[model samples]
Target: MSRTEQELRQLYASTRGMPTGAAKFAVLEEVIRHADALGLVEFAFDVRMSATSVFQHSWAPEKAFLTFSWCLAAYDREPHRFGSGHEHTLLWQFKWMAYSVYQYPEIPLQRGTDLLEDMERRYRRGGHSMHAVLQNRGEAAQFTGEVERAQAYYEEMALTRRDALSDCAGCVPSSQVQTLVALGRDEEAIRIGESAVRSGCTEQPQLIYSELLLPFVRSGLGERAVEAHRAAYRRIRDNPHHLGELALNLLFCVHSGNLVRGLDLIERHLSWLDRPRTPLTEMEFAAAAVAVLSRSQEQNGGDGGAVLRFPTVEGKRRPDTPAAELAVELRERALGIAERFDARNGNTYQSTRIRDWMDTGAIGEPLPLSVFERAANSRGGERLQRLLDQVADRTAAGDLVAAARTRAAAAELMLADEQYAEAAEAAEEAIRELDRLGLTADAAACRWVLARAYRMDGPGGSGVRALRELLDSDPWGREPQDGGPGVSPEAPQRLQPLPLLPARPELEAALGQWLGYGPEAAGWSLAAARGFAAAGREEEALAALGEALARHPDADAEPTDGVLADLLGETGAVLGRLFGEAGAPGRVGERGPTGPTGLTGLAGPADRAVSPTVVVLIAYAEHLQAIGRLEEAAERLRTACALLDAHPDTEAAGRRSTVLTDLGEVLLRLGDVAAAEEFARAALALLEPDDAWEEIVLLGKVLRARGADEELAKLLTEHGLELEDLDD
Candidate 1:
């Protein structure tokens, strides 16, 4: 084998240091040096933190960016060969420097401009074969919050690809698609993104999968987004270039009721990042940490929850206890590694969205009027003014708890300023007010924020516990007005966890019991079961189902008993199929498909109960189904159906025609020809005279499943279909 060939292989060796021995390193270095001597950037990563990084950078800034790029290539060659600390060393010292400068002007950015432009100009000669340069430019612009400029760059890149046939490879046109999305131009983003998925021209698996994935996520596309994401994952199964993208897509799968997909994505991302020689990245670890942390926070663990820690050194991972220590660590690292080169830059995130949330706590007390005065002059306008007024009134009325809620609105800015202690204090203060006012839900939410801040600052077992409780509780639940402690019995209603959810009597009852507002835990338990029943968590869904049945085994019961029986019977059918019959295990066709036998099984009982979250999913799923997107609709169904099988009871239960359409589709797919036809016939029967366009299509699906598509299509054409047609 050639010497160069051997060195390339050695570059990714299992045991560490440089991945290659000195001789191999020398050969590879010589090769890259030859490329650099000709002005080619073999790789691009930051190198300022290394012993010679600063010297190279200070001596020649342009050379530094290139050298850093090369170092990044080496790190990429086998990043896992290095430990997370080592990668963090390089990541902070160099990789992120570009963004730090772009986002925070306080950091030096002037030095890297020339290098950026150079990469651009040279690539432009190849008829806009400059996606890398354009992509970097987008990163830089976004980091600096130059939104318009960033959008322009990405748009131009997409346009360039369109005009040049050869340009269509690897990166795809994700630039325009996602940039438009981040800019809030969702219609165009979806139009272009979905098209790209169909075209299959994209080779950058990360970019393509993201394009495929976005229609569902950051969107109401519902279940349809599942197949798109899955298709993208399948496209890049063995492609390392798409590993990071693969990981997040998996998350999207999990979001859409594809747990297997989510878990597999985790493995794919880990395996790629875990390359031995360079060492898998700490970024992967940190991301995984966020995922776990996010879930733990969701658990509302009666006592235990996830906690976050900041790095002791500013750019490092360990969060040194005490602000002073962390600050000192940060300063030392900052002094040495702070960029004088191009600022930190990336996709829309600049950093991870998780980082943004961390840097800006979302639940602290309101800013003083002075802060609002400035905010009025800044990005926050009406919301800030309104929030300030509300907060002010609360304080004047001595309603500390009410005032605390306002703090959540203002926490972002305070957190941005690194006022962790202040944030913590405000969260705690709000919790006190809620507690004093006997507002359990409000208090619980405040605790969620407080716990987050506490965790961000240091150790956080207590914080995790608080977060867990909030997650476990029914945020949308309401309480009675007859009488309550520390609150007026006549008070209109208590704060619901999700303010937008329309109130339901049972939901309110369930939440009240969970929060210990008044009723015995039995009500909460019963309501929970009802919710699960509505959601298709049969066993839990039927806890109340059984009670309703047991109320009068014989006929001639009271009117109230009859009403309860009717409600329970309809809901009971769902519950029985979902969790299995009362004491038995969960049944098939009851919930979303799980394992091979348990499509109807719960995502685990804790998450199997009912929730208002189902309403949102059902609406979204129906919309997608109407759009000639059966696959997408199925995915949406999978997700919302899971929620349905879990929720206690719903106001706009899936009995609606839209939900019927979805159910009919699922039953047909599962080959329940008789049941599928039954559901479709019922949905069709909803209209006395004429069927709506969406319902008509749903009828068509029902017929198609029964091998009657030809007859249905003829009838539809004679009648005309318009459910998904915008003009109709």
Candidate 2:
């Protein structure tokens, strides 16, 4: 092989381990340039082909056109030199090129239409099915406001059999679903989407979930819509490539009375609008953000402003801007982009769609997205009546298991309503019926309700004992094993862990609060986290902690004299024993005399514990990092660090470094190399000449970012670590 070829191979190999994003794309572009300069025709074609995919996944898919055009021209001049494989790849890329053509007004409508016809002719000549060609035609027609034509093409595409050239199973249906929804055929869209989700696809559920959000809401299936939003948002929240898809979810939040949540989504992803992958996607996202921000502005009497954090140099923060101002700005940008598309298409279609979406009003009523929120926000009498109706219907049908399950559900609602006595009674009846029917899972759920009721109703420690007994008995007949928490073999997969999910987390948090500072409290909190993790409900878990924080003493206030002093003393004694680095080293609550509110002992010089708020905030940061919400996670970690900075406590002081290290890692993920380096250095400065692996690893990221290989090697040698040790 030639030296140039070997060099190209080495460059490609080095990039294999790099992540997919701007950096990788830039490197791939460089490789293409090198191949072109070295007079490697086929090699340059190969590199450009890879560059096209990288472009498609990056924030500028339209940028692929230049490289793709070169490849197309090369193939047309000498098809035999590249082989059938290259021809097929070239034809497939033609589909993307055709779609991209409509994204800009600079490319005329005739250009897109001609490209579609050319794609069809080539597919026929290559002996390929018209499936992919028809699909692209339909999408192009849809973009150009030819809904009827789009529908006809979609119908024809559906009838056509799949071939190696057709889009993936999930993708075609997702596109069709979008077209159907636009054509006022929501039910049909939902039908297609439901089936597609059931059968699965390469991007199953995730891609289709966003497409189905509007359909489900339009069909008055609000609960299902909420579930789709949660699932879709979780899947796409971390992916910068899914900005357009995430926009749909933001609109759902607006229509469903989740104004705060809509704002949260906006805050998390608004930076994506800075450089949207395509103008079409940018218009969609801006339209959605306008809708959300406008509604939020009205709700706040046009006074509340949202503080959005954009990616900035040196961890600099963006200024707080009013919702109305941001809304107007986004609205103009969206309308302008829409006008460009419409002008290009010689119609008002794109602009009208953008205006309609921006001005869209909420549906009849707000939909609560979580089980607990639904139960809590629902009207007490109406919700109870519905649960009772279910029980009556199940009983009349002679479905005893169903009736018992309904009763358990009703009991949960009753607890939320504070009807503790009636809830406890209902729970007992359900538990007996389920146990008799040999439904261990159902029975276990009822027992949890009963335990909760026992706690809320009266007898102190009754709820605690009952929960302990239930856990000890191993109601699932197994420990949490393989994959996640195990359930009884007979238990339904959907109902694993418990009946009311979010309710279980709430119960765990309550149990932790009731126990106060001890091993039991920490255990309960951990259990709550595990349950939430198993359910893929990170937001709800953090929310549960937030609720717990509210219930605890005024953590924001300093511990002075009087009641505050005594409270702190009591809290400090128990927390020091339970959580401090150097304590009695026995069971929590083993030291000190019993005092006010069941707290143990008085605070002394030896009892300086970290603030509970700081601890929980740090934990929230960690969980947020795990779920890919880097910016928000960094915010929470900074909050924790600030709290530590204010107090300067001796207990768990290493946590300050841990928080800084975490913030630095999150900055690294966000591509703020300078900010990441600063935080890493701060964390390292806080350390007292210790070789803490996490801090060292964070510093290593800083060195590597600067291409300081010599410095990194020396640091590693000094710390007795290796490059591999710092990976991941």
Candidate 3:
């Protein structure tokens, strides 16, 4: 063997019993890099083997794609170098291709089928061990929506398996179970799975359990479904990397009313879904998370909306009741994941399906504004109009709660469209209905809308008055009177506090009373700070932000804290403006009331256990930029870029693109025109055609400065972003 081959073999042997994670992948990557450098003919085969190991452990689509692409390329260049193991390698290659086709529909099915056919032709040449190849072909057929062909292939494998000597005997039963399930032979599938489990032939136990879960659940065998779920969970518990199996188990948990367990699994593993390595897996994870949360909402007697407003399950809690707060947190987290995925990937068919599920579930919620918001954001006017019509229908049908929510949403949409009169009318109707329904929380939201409408149109004070009433009433803490007009046994006794109403001094004072005390005080204070800032009361905004920072000291530790990050960013801007107004010295370590020019005092805890997030870094940079501290700002932007590189998720990618553009602008100010242009071009390349117009405009400026007018004009014309629109 060549020295490179020896090294590769030694590396693989060293990782034999090691756990799957970054460490294992790190070693594998090193071996692949070494193999590539040596120009070995076995490079493709080596990568394919490593890719199989990764798929078995992590199931990361991007990782698999990288290795598989290399393998295919190498095979094309030197097919003869595959040696005696060529047939086996071909089998595995085709199998992986089929798996990829199943996972990512974006990969055309014909490509996978063509690979499978090639493998079958090779198998026919030697007539040796075709069971595994045939079974995989069945899977590819099924994934491509060719059900009959898949079944035929699967049956052929089943018949051949008894006489064939193959290591994939266990896989045959598992495949058979899946085919049976797809054919609506649930009983047969369950029987086969159960028999395999009992006979000790379940080599791929996770697959068997996954196949059995749906059939058992659909058959109303909750106990059996639970058993399958537990088994599947245990099989993958150590790795916790099989997205498909995890999602299947989650579905069973939700469907069988094991919501607490489902939630636990989600909380434990949801963070792993952050990488967006595989669009299909990410989609599945989001769908499963949303489904679980929706079921939990229903079980708790709340509407199954993406936006969760309720605090308790069934308006009552025994000492044994699970924490409803955790459930709400999970629901919010799930919604965030779905939203981030949608933002990065845009609207794929899978994403749209998940969105539809959320929309349908939102109809059952106290407020369906989330659905309306999504429709408006996506420019799905037909969906918004349909929802409006539904609101009207609900009103005519006297479903007051549904009508009120839909009307409020309609009002928001009308406001967005700048139809102030229509917004006012809709908001008023919603408020009236909500008030009559005794939905204090819902009413408060509608009142806020009405207030905005009033402010925009005729009487600004009406909006302020509405906000004042909401605050003074302390609706969230109010007790329901026995037999009151708007009270029902099922109605929540205390209203959940509404998000901070549009910033008025009156609203600020009310929020202030809860500062450092209420459960939501930090959020309230942040809102108050935003209000004060908007009203040009910088000092008050700074004070409110101080209070917020004191309450949520660990903000930087939680990268998912988008709200807190925004608050911090806004506060940084405020502080920067204050520093600028006072004409402070341009020293790097200049101190303000908040400790440093960069708001370093806001960094939580003494050990600084976690580094500041990209959000915090960018926000601090923004503050520096606002105060004319260009060098410090550029350094902070570099830090943000590093953070983005470390965590290459969809959300991080979006942030990276923004930071690049910002960095380019900073570089331009520093007279590094060439470097700035390069950064701008890189940012442009990272962005999708439909990405934020702001980023595009920033990059356009760089291109314009460099006299790349052709590229600039092409970008503008392609994205339909006219120069006049940019000016607006």
Candidate 4:
């Protein structure tokens, strides 16, 4: 080994069992510097891996940022030397870069963009790159507010995983979940997340938990949120040293109304705060602590003037301290940390979060006014009422957009306090301002609040009538008027339809009117179809699907185009499901055997792109399976598997696995038990442990049917499945 490599190995061995802290990180910094002096390009990966441990344990965003920068610098010096095996390392660095940017919101956008450009450049070199590069790129785009670009990247990543059938398939799905959530596709995000979990992709429990919690809570799926929290706690229970994860869990607990448990978590993890932390962690910790403290004070029947006590450095709690005194103390501490971070690192995303936290005395941006509103609504008393009044005062001085938003927020507070008339009036005022400002989306949101307030007031069809009127007012769902204030001419066109309100019946009714009209006609149709399916109106759903299919008949034509890929995949999947449900006994796109059209028409193109070809083949195979053409279905799956295997650039390992799973099922139906077992086992090997459950169940059934009880038992044991559960 080279001297740098030898030193790295030595350090790794020395720190094998040691807990991460400032001392270990200090040594790592020196080692990285020494490696840089020696021009050890490969050693960059080693340095970064060690730094990642420190970042994870210490919650230090600076450590993550520095590590990624160093690694990227090494790659820049000698990009040619680093290839396939090293791509994962580069991907890891870039992922952390995005994470650091998110955690430290003051980080320069240019820095993140530069890193993303580098990754893109590397991937463009026509060599093997890790699947995670796409995910990292998406994350970077998301951090930079390039939502459309981010969505495209995330969709491509998902498509790549579906096509590739690679190991560790959970990563893409997990990323897609978050991206979908950010795009306001909360229900879809939750659906994707739940599917991944069911498929056994629970490796990153903390991520899964955090990502799923928000959407579930927003959608009022309390039981689901509790389930996610429990899973998160179970995963991190033995590894409580990760302060960031602990802080995130604490925040989730507080948000979910488990204040006592939140306090217990804080007390248990208090020692972690004493360790080295980046400004990001400090901000998160401070926010979580203050929220818990505030909740505790409310629970104790303490008014706004009541003093709040905190655990001392030694973790001893004092009962009587003024809340304002505590808030000021915490704010000062956060400011001091942020200042130090800014002085050392020249400002970062964390600084922005810290500033927001300090200014609002809250946990999150867009501010957690919901907490205060909840307190007041629940009769927690005068202090929260005063806070609401202050918000009203700010609204009076703010500009149009800000003033409108403040009113909507005030409306929420009023509604929570059961002041329905005030809520309605506030919402109406906000709606008028937003409408005049040409903020259609914002106006729609305000109308939703107003409608809710009307509903809560009882009797009369006022709420429904109000919603119907709002929908009618914008029948075509037009975009905000051009040249309107705050409407940028350069903004990307809307990627998806404006999300419908949570009121399913209203949304369904509005969607019914929008059929085959407007720019988002197909999207609206799909939403309606989903709503119908969820409501068990299968025939209505099928009819809606037919309308959507007619409107977007060319969805499968350009699968390589990032914008169209997700649409095509989703449409194809929906079509396949509907066809299966209909029990149709015809080939896909046959049209009475008058040659192919729609998705099937693209299947045999000699020059078809690999992604589109795979998607079309899958849809065709699904149709064949639904029509009892087992042999044909297997053939298509095998072809897809061969194509995926032959093209590594497509990174279709995940897709390959899907084919394998399907082929196994088809072969089993054909009574070819041995081949089915082989294919199923291969698919299971390519999938993560969590994702292998279904395959195990499949193979276990095959083994049992053939009276191969011993082998079935062995398979269950190897995959951590219990025979008893299988029996159940």
Candidate 5:
């Protein structure tokens, strides 16, 4: 090795040896030179390693800014060498690029565009090139809804450059081939793209060309897509450190009939997704890799004796609801994904090899939400096609951007349809394509959509990680609207909560629980609870609601009162969300309660922690109930109950009693004698209502229990609880 390379080895050695990271990293910094040194052939590798290590350790935004500056330094010298080291320096550099574009929000638009352009020029043909510059550009084109422009840019870029590149086949001719393909010169494009890969030109351009050619090779070339997947797999499988590359190869495996192995590959990514506060880009890679692989297996080759198949019930009959019908309600928005790559429309570009891309399980249409009960007659797979023609056709056309867009569109539609798990996957593909195409803002949109979908779906393990990424996505000021930088978490909101993207309380709570943080967790939990109440996540909104209610300082039996008696109860739910919901019911009396217009909603008189979400529902419910709309009041209570049930952490007793009380009231109004009695009795058992008035309410319990007058007479006389005899 050269002198500079020698130092790099020492840098790696020094860091590897030190138990203490900072000291070791300090040595690394001293030993390795930046990109300027021609002798430092491993410059990109060392710098990337150092960048990821440093970011993991410090995570200070400034540290990242410095690292990105170092990354940019590479371009200053060997501009074409931007994606050096087979694009192995990806996570480190991609994260930096995203951060650089997203942070420093105050930078002018012209400057921002100039910076991106410069980066593209410097790093135009590698994995980093495709995933970064091209992806970002595609996003920009997409966000303005410039479908044709986006398609052209993405197809050209996706076809010409790729990750896992070789160094020998220089990309000029490949670029020419791609241009030819863009002009509809299929034979020329296919020949050049396939030849480059076939000749073992693993250069960045060739790999990109190979990816562009995958569908056609499988379709007519026969087994080329399979061979390419195997080649890609061989290059990546040994090193678990090649997490991103491994994931990509795994995606190909699913379509190539090596799906059993793809599961193992997807599983490895779970580790990354399980971490708290993972960066958005990393999250996208992991989520996409796993989701696509899973789809590939489930969607394809299962008729009769095909290798892959969806799990089916043995003896048990299907549920009244059919799976496909459920899937549509689940993947409604995903319909767009199917269309995104279709070669049928007036707007269609390529999309002929859709079958090649899809090895296939579900390319079925989504059922409308309103027909839930009657939908069991939905598409039964017994007589199913082994492959979905949708994705395969698109892939054959060499329109990767469109393929990815289809997935994203599918994810969005699925989310709208309430099919959370599948939606997250499609969104991931969309993001991957967007990132590759340089569609920064559009990528952000997809990430938020993914996060929001997972927020409701993916289990705590991967879902929370997804949300954290969305929250951490760089603002880039490149949002479709004027939403400025750092407004990432707002991705879930259609309007893009720009100008600022502070975590919603509900999201904060989920992260807090997932991350194992304390106050921050409570804060997020509180926020989420309130948001759900606003959005009617009813059962899911209760726990936060009850604590908020109990913690409010004014939760008493009020000034012989007006209409606000119901509102006092909301304090418990709100506080439950903010502080730990531990030991809450007893603490609820501390919340002030008064009569009439004066009783402000849920919050302690002294603490501003109580937000409006708590007080408003109660007031609204009670108001409506008082106006003789008992049904509305019951729904409000049910809403609170649902919120509590969904909270991961909640005081069990408090959550239970609060929900039971609402159920009791509703059942009583509906005239369900036994049901009302059971509900009330359950609440009374849990709610230790000790006061004279509460005792009177409990007396009604006795009447419901035994022969009305028999037990009541004995209890009333012994307790001296005559309503006629006692004066207030």
Candidate 6:
């Protein structure tokens, strides 16, 4: 081959790895250009044939028709130049063009009939069975509301033998299910849908799932309808090609009393209506949007004047449009599109479908899409009963996000009920979901509960391992995999397992800390330190202790004497510096005290004690506090404290002292002086000689409020912090 031909072949081959979308379309277009320039008809034919399928699947029906027309013209002019496989391929593509014509009302219904006639003539010339042609004729009849003619075609097609051009076994029933649904044969639609879904077709559940949504609901199968919605919507949410199916889902959402989810779906896909792939899909989508908006207005005290945000063509949301106004506009748009189809078909089928969706009533009570909401809405055993009823269904439906959360909630209930083993099992189920969705912080929190359940259950070391693993790997994986620059090159020493404590309130509090939970992170850290100390993990205990001190520098350290004795030869040197038994250099009044080590020397290894995330949180908290966002400031500090607890390696030493001091200041601003004082004291306990002067001053304010001026002055004097800085 010439270098140009070789290059063209490489370009064509490269498309196999690409996803089916506009990107692939661009690549194929370039290949076609190159082939046309080189007078390579065979290469151009193959490329256009391939491009036709891509266009068909990627929301480009017009492009599909245009590309297929070129191939058809070329084949007609010189059929002998192309391979026999091209003939079969061309015939297969004829099926797509047959039905696609109905999606465009601009194409006369006579044009559709003529295309089918040509398709039948071609198949007869090729000596092929008329199975595929007859099948599409039924579809065409249904699309035009010729039910009697459609039924006759379907019956005749059913008796015909399968051929090379026939639709796949799974797809045949899937198409019939839609027609059956349109014909109001709800029970038969459900039955065939169930069988078709079980056997699996080309689109499998995605197609049949949406087909059965209305049928399932109308047959009083509420739960199945919900499951079908969850499963099917997830598959098609990102694909604009599934606009019609999405409309079916939206109507299902409305009839099932899930107006919230329906509106959410509308917002997500509203922009697609701007340049919709087909008029049929646009009508379907607009009709669905109208239904959702109309019902939402009813729910809003029947006030159509309430404004709802809808997406613009640029993908930004604008909320100026009133609900009633937008609904009426969409209703007109849908009906207008439907009228074009009706005029072409000489029937009202398309318009009637739109009208029916607009007038549909709720088929059942509101079903909460979220497992969390369902559990929250129920009482006592009802909560458990509701969760249990749907957890299995959601899991089976492959809704991992909902399934994981549901499992986590169930595990919590089991844990509280003291059913430890079952809690562990439930937690494991949630973890599997976590693996599928990627590690969420919530999933990690759920795992923490599992660890506690194992610890409470008995003698196995499972809980210890679980907790250790939780700390070793960041669930968020936000940390650098290589532990960041300047770290040791050699493999770090393995950490010994922490002994399980009899009670682990600190562990629970640490892992459970998240947004919207009131801040108690500093207390949790101190509690964690006490637990670690009791468990005989000296390094981790000291780390936790240091973290507590960092967060609550002024708070009293528990087992202080023991930790001091254990780490240092004696408590005197560190205690003297901390308790004012000695004075420091450069103070307002005193000489430097002699000691083998200072406060900094008492901390765990520096690298092992700092977490980048904890530091960032504290820094952000500082910014939030300065901006008068006191609640957010407090929450950030609490999160930092929780991180300190979660990561025993990230201790209270050094920088964490700032976390505690900052939290104290934020709480003080929020008018909680007592809580402020606790953090101030905890922070003070961890402060080193080089600690920030402002932090010391903040601590002084907390203590001064409670009339501890003399003690605060003494504490400041020992650190050599001048009162002159406080005067400013």
Per-residue error (Å), model 6, residue 281: 1.0
Model 6: residues with Cα > 4 Å off, grouped in runs: 1-3, 305-322, 364-369, 373-728
User: What TM-score does candidate 3 reach?
Assistant: 0.41
Best by TM-score: 6
lDDT at 657, model 4: 77
Relative to the unseen true structure, what is the C-alpha lDDT of residue 297 in candidate 4, on a scale of 0 to 100? 64
- lDDT tens per residue, model 5, 548-663: 33332231223222213333334334444322244232333244432232223332322222223334344444444444556655655555444444442543565556456555
In Å, residue 242's CA in model 4 sits off its true spot by: 4.7
On lDDT, the candidate that comes out on top is: 2
Per-residue lDDT tens digits for candidate 1, residues 280-394, read 1123233432343333333444233322222111122332133223223323322222231123432334333434322221112221212322333434445444565666677
Across 148-193, the per-residue lDDT of candidate 3 in tens digits comes to 7788987787677432324354566777776777677898888777
Candidate 2 on 50-169: residue-level lDDT in tens?
A: 888778766778769988989999989998978888887888888889878887767888878888888989999988999999999898988899988998999999899889888887
Clashes found in each candidate (C-alpha, N, C closer than 3 A)? 70, 1, 1, 30, 103, 20
In TM-score terms, candidate 1 sits at 0.30
Against the true structure, candidate 2 reaches a TM-score of 0.53
In candidate 5 the C-alpha lDDT for residue 162 amounts to 51
lDDT string for model 4 (21-64, tens) is: 55667777767777767766567566676676567545465767
User: How do all models score by TM-score?
Assistant: 0.30, 0.53, 0.41, 0.40, 0.28, 0.53
Q: What is the lDDT of residue 550 in candidate 4?
A: 42
